[model samples]
Target: MVDDTGQKQTPNTLEEPLDLNRLSLDEQIYVNMRNDREFQGRLHACDQHLNTILGDVEETVTTIEIDEETYGEMHTSTKWNTSMLFGQEDGFVLVAPSLRVG
Candidate 1:
């Protein structure tokens, strides 16, 4: 296969889920974390345990509160930016398009 730039594309032979992170090195990626937290950043490094280091990160956290009287859920979203961050393996809920199952 060839990419848009006409460069030959290698087959995505991902033997393990962690291999996806390897392919995403130095590239933009989105990670969904526990507790309604989400992160978008450039992947700097990752380990076999799924722990990752990211740069130029944007983090978003969402919280839901129930109105006692109205019985309605109110959602609050908070966003912040950071130069770099380290993500622990267990904190990750989901990672982006790189990892897929057939």
Candidate 2:
């Protein structure tokens, strides 16, 4: 669509109902997995099964521990980046392109 000045505006993809394959096409997306792991990447390709090829991927793995003496919690997070990645559909918690992470 174009504005009054005749400049084209980016389509709001969110206006459409989202399904996995549609949302995965050429967008920045987040994939939450089992075991407290999350992946953020630009989705290049995907299928109905949710198996995907992602580029410029960042992976964050969170770990929590308790101290025996204080009974306090210790939380740790490790993050890494990769140029490209492939993911299986197994153990996927959610895949969202709209949600932003801190």
lDDT of 2 by residue, 32-70 (tens): 999899999999988767778889999999999999999
Candidate 1 C-alpha lDDT tens digits along 18-59:
878888898889999987999999999999888899999999
What's the CA RMSD for each of the models? 7.1, 6.7
Best by TM-score: 1
Model 1: weakest 10-residue lDDT segment is 93-102
Candidate 1 vs. truth: CA RMSD?
7.1
* lDDT (Cα atoms) of all candidates against the true structure: 0.88, 0.82
Candidate 2 local accuracy as lDDT? 0.82
> What lDDT score goes with residue 18 in model 1?
80
- C-alpha RMSD (angstroms) for model 2: 6.7
